[model samples]
Target: MATDGHGGLIQPRKVPNPVRESQSHRELHRELLFSHSRGILPRHRAELPRVLESRRLRQLREELQGPPSDLEQQLRKCHQRLEEAAAGPDPGPRPEFLLVRDSLRKMKLAEPGAWQT
Candidate 1:
């Protein structure tokens, strides 16, 4: 069983590395810019008219770069997890039982027939 800094058997959460995340986003943007310049739009990239593409590029240039959108961030996190899972030891038989048991033990519900509708 795995132990944490607190000496508990609970599994430790995987933390995303900011350096790796920034590298991933940089690569994505570089690829998009290359594709745009070459007029080679991959199916996954959103289709845009030439005018819109120019506008988007300008907007991208102007905006003070901030964190990625939620969906993009989520995809990055999932990719990180997949890479780690592929390279690391298999987590056989996850301790789902412990989770369920803990949840049930703390279960709380409103009174029956609390709603008349």
Candidate 2:
């Protein structure tokens, strides 16, 4: 991560010397930025957008901006998981589930049961 002149953490940048960064470190940085932009150093939030809008993020964004292959794969996995969840049976009963049930009952019987049910 780079820092602004005021010592605030800025968005992660491509290492000025790429040779100094390991592949794992680069991958980790990419994931951190992509997954949770807010989770980055708290101070970075203020500096990030400015840096991103500036030539710095633009240059790096152009070079390393495409969705990482890992993210694409994870997204696919998430879709698959959602599909599975939708297709699968509910795991079990939940009490809060009855809140909506009760609301619908009230709506259906609004005239007589509005206050009773």
Candidate 3:
């Protein structure tokens, strides 16, 4: 650890540090900047497998990628159990299971309907 004359810590470098960032991050950043004309599309990164990131980097990029937290894991387990138990979509036959149509429903409807009409 470098320190100044008054025993204060030295200022960090203004340049990017390899130690502070993973290789994937640097490569992805460059790729995005180089492809700026594409307008920040998610499909652009689909070719680059994001699994290469380290746990710390992944944590830092939680919005993009990371292993679920304890609470999320527990919730996922509970959700799985509920799904497995066939407890969903039951009781007097609900209407559409949801009050509103979301992306999933839109995507499903976007395809041809199963009916012969």
Q: What's the lDDT for all of these models?
A: 0.77, 0.76, 0.70
Please report the candidate that would top lDDT against the real structure: 1
Pairs with backbone N, CA or C atoms under 3 Å apart (clashes), candidate 3: none
lDDT (tens digit, per residue) of candidate 1 on 1-117:
666676786666899878757978889989989998998777655556666888988789758666678998899999999999899995776599987887765553443355345
Model 2 scores a C-alpha lDDT of 0.76
Stretches > 4 Å off in candidate 3: 1-21, 38-40, 43-79, 86-117
| Best-fitting candidate, scored by TM-score | 2
Instruction: List per-candidate RMSD values in Å.
Output: 26.1, 18.0, 15.7
Q: lDDT tens digits, residues 1-117, model 2?
A: 566675885567665775537798888778778757556564556775766668776788767867668877899899999999999998987688698999878787876755565
lDDT for position 36 in model 2: 78
Model 1 misses residue 100 by how many Å? 33
Sliding window of 10 residues with minimal summed lDDT for model 1: 108-117
User: What does candidate 2 score on TM?
Assistant: 0.29
- Model 1 scores a C-alpha lDDT of 0.77
Superposed Cα deviation of residue 76, candidate 1 (Å) = 0.7
Give model 1 RMSD, 1 decimal.
26.1
**Ranking of predictions according to lDDT:** 1, 2, 3
* Residue 75's lDDT in candidate 2: 96
Name model 2 segments beyond 4 Å from true.
1-68, 96-117
Candidate 1, pairs of clashing residues? none
